[model samples]
Target: MTGIVNDAGNAATYAYDASGNISSVARGNAAVSILGFSPGSGAVGSNVTISGCGFSATPSQNTVQINGAAGTVISASSTQLVVQVPAAATNGPISVTSPSGSATSSASFAVTQSSAPLIGGFSPTIGTPGTAVSVSGSNFQTTVNENSLVFNTRTALLSAATATSLTTAVPTFSTSGRLAVTTPFGQTTSSQDFYVPPGAHVVSDVAVTGRMAIGSSQTVSLTTAGKIGLILFDGTAGQRVGLQTTSSSFGSCGTGSLQILGPGGSSLGSTALCNGNYLTAVTLPTTATYTILVAPIGTMTGSVTFTLYDVPADAAATIVPGGSAVTLTTTTPGQSEVLTFSGTSTQRVSLTLSEDSGLGSDCTYISIANPDGTFLVPSTLLCSRNYYSNVLTLPATGTYTIKLRPYGTNKGSGTFTLYNVARRRDGDDCPWWPRDHADHHGSRAGRVSDLQWICGPARKPHHESGQHSLVLLVDFEARRYGPLSLRGLWEQYIRRATDLASDWHIYHPPCALR
Candidate 1:
């Protein structure tokens, strides 16, 4: 204020001090006005400025309000002022306040959520042709449409829609395999193949009787006479009798008579001798009883004599005390020998017989104490009457005697006879009677011994108390070598097993054998 004053116009003034410093000064006051106020389209925060108001201004008496709400100003000057933009103050008009007044401007900000909806996978991917498939995706809308989901090569309708996924019903398509899916923003496909998965030949009946039988033929079938062949064996080779048919005064009708035709079709023995059902003769070939039909002949009608007898050379057989007699060396039909024995105590004894004639009649019958005839051994002893013959074990050591009983009285004669007897070091006689504990099929305790004879009949039943009169039938028609058709053998095994089970309380295999 201590200076020389210089006055020019009335609106201006200036002054100079004695030390050459200008001391008089004057300020020009201007009214505060927000001429230019703008915000970014998506701008947030309260950073506002009102330029051209004054120079070098500061936030001394200036403040701001975001969205009309009071807020602290960060920086204030003549040109700009900045304040914190509250989170809730987005997308609204912002205001600033100076000493002169307040100014407002339009503003907008982008809004964002915490997260976006998402989906994972679908269950039970397989379905019928026209089934609804569940879709899984992200950012889904409730307004489902064709653009929401898609099916590969199949027409689909969006039946359901949600924020997380949609369900689309599939349409009928002629094709098969994996399917694909798509949406507005992305696409996905199935990794599996769909398909429809595919649905045995089943003998109906069988019948049989005698040598001739009827049944369902297998892969191969035969229908001729010579197509059938027949051979005889005494557990070894075929005998010497040619097969022939006759049509004379004594000729056989239908299938003709079965004669033992020699080399020239001439009857070897008398043709009349071989014309009956069960033959009983003292003189004939051991093979006279074996007349098996070679092929499946449907049904049989005619009959032939099966003669069986005991030759005189087999008499006076060696007998073992308390057991059966020692067999002879003659294999002939109807050829039985007698034995004489004298003893006491009745300890168990056994005998072995040689099957000379395989006519199915090489059995032994003991006349022990008159009408008290039991099988020389259990029928199991006669397992196979072939080359390696059978051994029979007897029970009790006593004065007993027996006779070599031929099977059919016409077949077990001539050639082979009984050898010596031996004992089965392992078990006792087959428990068919008094002793009643053993019942399993594999139990060998009461099998066969060497002193008894399992003659005549097959699979003899075990009896309990008193001595019973037993009659056995020799089965010589079974094959002993190679493969056996055994068509009816199961029925026979069942029959035998049932008999043994009832008599001895044993459980055998079922009625069928493989």
Candidate 2:
């Protein structure tokens, strides 16, 4: 095949092979054409495939340049060629040339860095100020000048680094945010956020209890603004722990508060500002180390006394019908002892508390509580007296708690006896109501009439029955006035009844007069 073209008044002839392929073209100059290229953009040292109409079949003679840098040709064909981007290449147009002519691409090829930094993960994801954390990744430079670690936009001081790992101290101002590492190539950010612990003062368990004193105060230094002082204690489940703070002598320093924080920094309980003293108690939720955070609410600058007490576990004992009496004593002010006993519904129990004669103060009491920490009967106060006793009928079918504590601020020792009482037959000692056949011809006074009939003589009773009957009468009177107020009307009635019963016992007086 042959074709003719007029080139500058000179006739140029183009010849083709019998297979319809270009054999040789007689033109003034060798022209080149660029159609397209695969992967139009790449980084340095990356292999790029360029496709266009070209004249060269030998790859070594063909030259490819990107961004003014010479590219190494890997292979060449009549319509396609592969070349490696030079290391010094920049973002610019690509050019290809042969011994015949040269062709420039219409589009530019982007030349970027070879490898970007990648983050795998970091150790000690949660930390506080000055905490050292190790970050592991790839493409990190060993030189400090070329590599940098940033936490929440704050630059961290690098201690050491390798190609895949870096060690740095957490910045003081760092917060909870993404961590990023930057190199000469590019920057890579962590997939998750690193956690920074809330600022707090680290304190030991012994330091909290041994240093702070009552009445006398001590200064608590804070490291940062609004900082909380943390005290850690190892605790067991089912243990009762008490925290009390004496009134602050800050004078004008400002107010502060205390909180019981759980294992995970959750608030369990707190105390209110009462004068300067605050008290709180909690039963441990789990057998683990717990954190107590003492934070200032306003301006905290004064001295305060902090106290912690671990209440002993309740020593439980069981009592049956006509069981032997058991005695307990209060060892400290506000100290409590718990006794557990099981009984069916409507079972009657008699509890007796007698102050030790050797002691001068009458500051002791006893209370009955249900299984779920609710009061079944209010507490009984036995102050300024030698002996006190009461009888209660159980209302629920479960274990009952007999709680004994000191009556007032002073800790006074006393002996307490508890036993199950058999319900009196024939209703002789029934202090609640009169018997069925007995005449109800008394004044209509509410509790007064009930007290008179219970304390009065039985219709056919004589001998030792009066003593036990009188004891029940006093117990009913004490119950009427509550256990805490055993001194006023109930004591007077007891004194009068004891005198009259003693006279009747010796003289064998008639039932109506007695």
| Best-matching candidate per lDDT | 2
- lDDT per residue, candidate 2, 73-173, as tens digits? 99888667899988888888888898767877656788766577888999876677688899999999878767889875468999898999999998875
Reference-based lDDT, residue 118, model 1:
47
What stretches of model 1 exceed 4 Å from their correct place?
1-313, 322-325, 345-399, 409-434, 442-514
**Which 10 consecutive positions of candidate 1 have the poorest summed lDDT?**
196-205
Q: List the candidates' TM-scores in order.
A: 0.22, 0.42
How much does each candidate deviate from the true structure in C-alpha RMSD?
35.0, 18.2
Best by TM-score: 2
| Worst window of 10 by summed lDDT in candidate 2 | 501-510
Task: Please provide, for model 1 over 286-384, each residue's C-alpha lDDT reduced to its tens digit, 9 standing for 90 to 100.
Answer: 321232222222333322322222234454544543344344443443345455454333233333334444543433332333123554432232323
Question: How many angstroms is residue 475 displaced in model 2 relative to the true structure, after the best TM-score fit?
Answer: 13
